[model samples]
Target: MKINNYQNKRDILIVDDLPDNLRVLSEILIERNYQVRKAINGKTAIRAAQLSMPDLILLDIKMPEMDGYDVCKELKSNKKTAEIPIIFISALDDTIDKIKAFEVGGVDYVTKPFHVEEVLARIESQLTIQRQKKQLQKEIEQRKYTEEILHQSRAVLSSVLNSSLDGIAALQAIRDNSTGEIIDFRCLIVNPVIAKVFGKNKNDLVGKIGIRKIIDKIDNNLFNSLVKVVETGKSLSTDLYYQCDSLKYWFHFIAVKLGDGCSVTVKNITSRKETELELKKINLDLETFSRSVAHDLRNYINNINFAGNLLAEEINLDGSENEKELIDIINLSCDRTMSILEGITQLSQLKSEPIKPISFNLSPLVSEILNYLQNNEPRINIKFMIQDDVFVNADRKLLNIAIENLIKNAWKYTKKTDETIIEFGEIKSTEKLWQEKIKLIDISPLQFKQKSIYFIKDNGIGFNSVLEKELFTPFKKLHGDSDFDGTGIGLSIVRRIIELHDGVIWAESQLNQGAAFYFILATD
Candidate 1:
């Protein structure tokens, strides 16, 4: 049988061996605006139905090779065509035959020479029921998919909450009955880590009101902060110290409001607090020891200088040139020793001394120091290249000390040369150099307006650059006393003075090639 366009119509298949019976059913269904199909034999009907599944099937019980019962059985056995509603119309009208038809997955049974109206009614009823069954099936599958997604989400949330290192707990606020004001909080959920800190199992803490059991163990501040967060809906954080029996701990508590309750996280900070206190005590002791040592050594050096002065006066004038040279050496040694003691005393007091910053011209100060050095050493030829009106805001006395140390070191190192040149001038620093200096000192560069890069360059014999790291360390000498005379504390003092004024100092040099000491001071 030919098929018509069934796109907008429910399809119905009529199966029978008699062509007349098939024609009659198809005429009735096609007149009702349903796409109709016809199969003459049971095997052909099964094949056609499987190829294009129909909304309903009308089968004749007795057929050529395969009967309607066998056809229905075949269709029901296969998953694809099993749900198509089957109605049997056959001449075997016995009660047993009708019962057998339904037993083989037939929906309704009609007698042979059936009424066309009855057939149409039965077909409409079955189609309505099939649509309802499909809709219900779709709902069931969708509900199953939704339930699986919900299960996976819950598993992920559970894993994240349990895997946290900090102690975590969620609380529900308990309010007064009459006033509707929050009176206490009941624990809703708690991670295992928090339960361990309180010395209890996680299950035991759930649904508990008021943590009276562990109240004395932890500081009351933690509870108060949580209460405040719940009432005001504001977050709070603080450090708490806990001590119970032999156990002592420091805890940092953070609480944030959530709905009518709050969530809290706790971390132990005992080791960190202990380390800070220990370091504080060590620094205090070291400062006290340094002050005592510096005082005693200064007095001893003063006495030695006094004794040396007496020896120089008592020495005979008509002595060997070597004898006179020995006397000169003793006097020079005494002066150097006194200078070292003074440097130590100055360094020891740097921390205690308060900085009194004032605007002062640096050019005049450099000139003054150079003039004093010239008066002391008349034989050496000295030259300078100082910048005019180089102003700086720093402690006048400290700045003077730093400049004097730099110039004196330059003069001492260049003593062997016929003509010595010491240049004191300011150089413009690039943004890259300023940034690097800020990083070295670990301070904010944004606070500075402009930096004054001053350098004290000398045409003297400079040491190797490899020893630059140890140059500013106390008692760290690069050259021996026989080669260059110094106490090795001058540069250290200069560094300290510059640091006190929020400045940085460094040097660059090579063997036998002149050394230049550079310092950066903030102008604003």
Candidate 2:
């Protein structure tokens, strides 16, 4: 256990009439890293301590001027120093004096003709108790600070989130007190902004099911987005165009995932969303007009070529070859224009498409994808070791696209001397998740027949470990485009798919050594 910085040192004040007794006590305490403050008389002792406080006080019961009782009373009178522990050390054998010493705020008494061991033991015991007391004080202060922070945080967050015209809420998973089993999570806190959007009071929402319970009462589109944030554990900021009570309203929501909970702020973006829709509609009309114009021009060019053939039959042979060359150029230019238009249309379609999840066996998909790559490229010896029965509930088409991209890159980047190897399987255990996250996998779960881990290993030209963070980002390429031909979207897509399935993806690699992609596909 580690002690805090404030409570690391002990301070002891020894007040005695005898210089020899003070000297002996000082030596014993200073040897143990205690700061020793000495005073010859009661008056001097109080003055010495007032200048700098000590953790524990050792006062002589009998003194020449202003006895120990008077000194203890003065010290205890000041609120700044009242809590300090005072121990009486004296030659008085009478129980009445001992009782009087305690009445003046003394904690313990040391009988006269002090044994070195006895003094040391009592000092140790008092210091131990002082340490414990200081620790408890620190804990209480921390709890108070935490409560204050929570209170302030709740006020600020609620105020900011609820003020928006868009409905926003916070939700946490409720658990059973006895068994820790998850019960239904109800809304514990909500802001006024959320209340106005749903046409209800904040008090009525204390035990409700967040936005899910009243989405139809507010806006169904906003409800769907709230659901997305809960499932994904990712921040969502989007503009929604929907209707509530037969009146159209656009809401922009910014939701942050809080690990089994969430906090969202909604902004009334109705005007902005309406403007965006109008602009989009204008752009669509322009696109339709362009396509129509292109189609009309193609027809006009065809008619011109058809008429040019009739003119060729009636004209003389002079300049005929040049005329034919001009006609051929016109035809090729039209063809190129059509191809460019088609490609643009395809790119637009890919951009606007939504992501959908579909389930399929990954084992056959991996094998078939690898077989196709190997068959096309005979020189690359692709060795794949997939645990046969492995299956996952995810978007098969997207998974195939991601795996194929990784496999293709692996083949492309294989070192001349190294054999390309790929492996996959499932891992299911809390211990394994910790191990994989912290690089200290607990193999103990294997003895008890726990869920096994699944991983993907590959042997290819690896990059620096320092660059792993940016690897999954869109258009972030570790290797040059010429060295490995890619648009830099393969790993980005893979990460997106894994994220969609609520899984974690990480890479382990070193320069010149191969890399492995490890991911855990959490099952429901």
Candidate 3:
């Protein structure tokens, strides 16, 4: 058997014991542009088909050594060539049972001395059917793959919806008959979270249209906004207040449109609202207390200062140096006490005021504070190292206070030192460097991070590093009143200001050496 021809043509193998029969069939197939293989016996036919599988096989039953029925059965049994259509060549009055030919995987059996037209027709018909089966099988496999992908996607979506912490719901808009205006929403799909929030079972909520109506009644704008989202395909996010008999609640919700429906997520914010109200009440009390302390205590201190001045002018203290010094001490006490009270009042006001950040150059602000300090204390000599063109996004009024307090502290602490120096600049850092400890190690070699880190370094009498953590705690101080003068509230106020701007501030200090403050703002 030979099958060397390789082209876009159908292949057929013809088997017979007679050389004439084999030659006749091969010529007829070749004339029809069919690649044909001739075999004189069953053994040669089976080997040829297996080696290079033909689309069809023609077998002769009365062959020597091996028969057509056995060859067809052998080819059918093998998985690779099993589907090749096999047609038996047999006589009408054959020794073998004709019914048994088909049972042995024969598609059709031809009579002895078969006609050329009849043999060609049988081969064409079986080849056509095989092509159709392959086409159908390919379509079926593609459909199965698509169906599996769809199933997996649905499963993942179901998992996300069910596991969400916030209440999740899918609602289809119910429109009016004439205007097509959405009057209400019908729950199409709801996750377990939605069921829990609505205080009902998930199964019960589906297909229900009244749940959203009850919720919409709590907030005047909720229904209208939901309808708008579905109609315009725009998203809506807002806070809603709901009150019922002996029940009050606050919820933050967002709605996004999906075709004629909307997907919504609701989060309970009742605790947050309650806390805000409580803070408001506390702020009111704090404001009143600050006013009373300012008015009542301020007048008493003013009277002491007045009386001390009058006594010093009225008395004749000739050779009475001790008496004059006592009077000076009383005057200084009154001034220091008033400054402390003013610090407390400023601290309270900052706590209550809202912060609004704006971009501005920082160098000028630092220079102004430094000039004010130097002008007031003309005898003191201090050097300032300020970075130019440094812009920061922070509340102007609040930042002024923070910078003033820090610079004032630097001035006070460095009074005894041989030379005073203060530097302000930006320190670029990466996320990993955010956790970098401020030790004796240099930081110039570190790579820049995504966010800008700023630092203020002062060559002043620094506090012990052991007390650094407590430095931001209210009313906590490291140095005593005889050594330094401060209310110990400035650092705490600075900490609060940093937190409000979504930033962090930290410092490293060594006693009698120096201190540096590092901070990062997260406005972006």
Candidate 4:
């Protein structure tokens, strides 16, 4: 994994009483791309290691100052150097000293005049084991992080559902038994906002068998949006303008797919909507009037200002009056519109903004995304193989978008599998090693040209290999929209985000098997 700097060579400390032994070991480790440090005796070894920690240590069993067993025990006692693995090398082949070497925290024991191959193999083994332990620890921490995010999200959702000003309802789709058509939605839960809007008791609506004629006048457009979300399991957010005999309002409707149905939130945005329209019309008419008329009207503003002072003073006398409520609403709407316009202006010019990159761990981020996906489909028992401590240097926001799209894509494709397994990890730096270890997908998409290749793999309904070239093309699809309900822009968006970080994405798959996506970012 790209947990740390993979380009950096491993460091090894060799301690021996004889200069010749240290020289020989140093050369061997250096040849294998390891940074080697030498100390002629135990005391010197301990001092050198305490000053600069090495990845692994080779210590002689017998020395003038102190034996290797004592040296190992002392090193293990120190918190900073405790994790460094030590392999004891000495002339003493006695089994008793070997047991003592292990008792004192020596990872392995090697006799004197050991074969070069055997010594190298033992050293590599110890280092590999140490790396694995660190990886496991990171994975455990990431799992905890995912659980915490899930718990916090559910809590916040509960709070919003219970206390939000918006009409909130939990619904279950009533489907046709034979053809699986969502005929209507049954209210599984409802809050006071929703109850008040429909003019029904909360208790009465809890088990209602259909979309409870919202406000006694449900529009066709609103009904269609609800059905579409439940059918396709997609989210919907729209500003809908509604008008009736007594009501003229705009509602912001948001529907998110929950289980077999969807949760809906209806926000009344009539005041803001009306203000926006009124201001736009006034600005248009004023500019036109300026061009048409001969008079440059400065006196009109004074007259309006004088009228405003009279209106404000009169309204302040009766706070419950209609004029007072209208003034309050207008003031609120103006302030909200200003803030919203500022945000919209900034967001619209996306290319003008430069990305801010930072180095961070990917394990927790991927875990959080996976947990969210699992919650959406609580019935799916997906086995996740998330590599630990995977670190990346990129714009966190852009990278988050990339990771979420990729993971959500994987989650969607794997929905049909009887036994689902999704993996988020990286290919090893060596191609030969990772090729053999890449089992997350049925077919391989493993490319280890870089030091490491980040990957997200899934055992899902894979796409056609012939469409590989179009995988990241905007709106290009390997599958029909009828079969998989998506605009086919998800992968394209992921590619754009990855490209912004100076990276490339690739995919490979066999039909009906599985697919794997690989990406590698350029290092600074």
Best by lDDT: 1
For all candidates in order, the CA lDDT equals 0.83, 0.71, 0.81, 0.78
Per-residue lDDT over 1-103 for candidate 2, one digit per residue giving the tens place of the 0 to 100 score: 3455336668889998989989988988888677788999988877778888898999997788788999999999988678889989889979999999999
Residue ranges of candidate 3 with Cα displaced over 4 Å:
1-56, 60-84, 87-135, 138-165, 171-187, 192-215, 223-238, 244-246, 256-262, 269-331, 380-382, 427-450, 508-513
What TM-scores do the predictions have?
0.52, 0.49, 0.71, 0.40
Candidate 1 on 59-92: residue-level lDDT in tens? 9988878999999999999999999999999989
**Shift in Å, residue 396, candidate 2:** 21
- Alpha-carbon shift of residue 84 in model 2 (angstroms): 4.1
lDDT of model number 2: 0.71
Pairs with steric clashes in candidate 4? none
As a whole number from 0 to 100, the lDDT of residue 127 in candidate 1 is: 94
Give the count of colliding residue pairs in each prediction. Answer: 0, 8, 2, 0
TM-score of model 1 vs. true structure: 0.52
CA displacement after TM-score superposition, residue 373 of candidate 1 (Å):
10
Q: By lDDT, is 1 or 2 better?
A: 1
* TM value for model 3: 0.71
Leading candidate by TM-score: 3
Tell me the tens digit of each residue's lDDT in model 4 across 1-524.
55354448788999888888888888888888788888988888899999989999999988886878888999999999999999999899889988988999999999988899999999989999999999998999999999999999988887877788899988998888999887777998788887776667888889888573662274667777778887788899988777756878788879999988889888989999899889878866765564343133324444544565677788898656778777665554444444334333323223234678899999899999999878887744669999999988888887897899899888888888887898999665676755544443353343323446788999999988888888988667787755665656667777777767666777878988989898777641
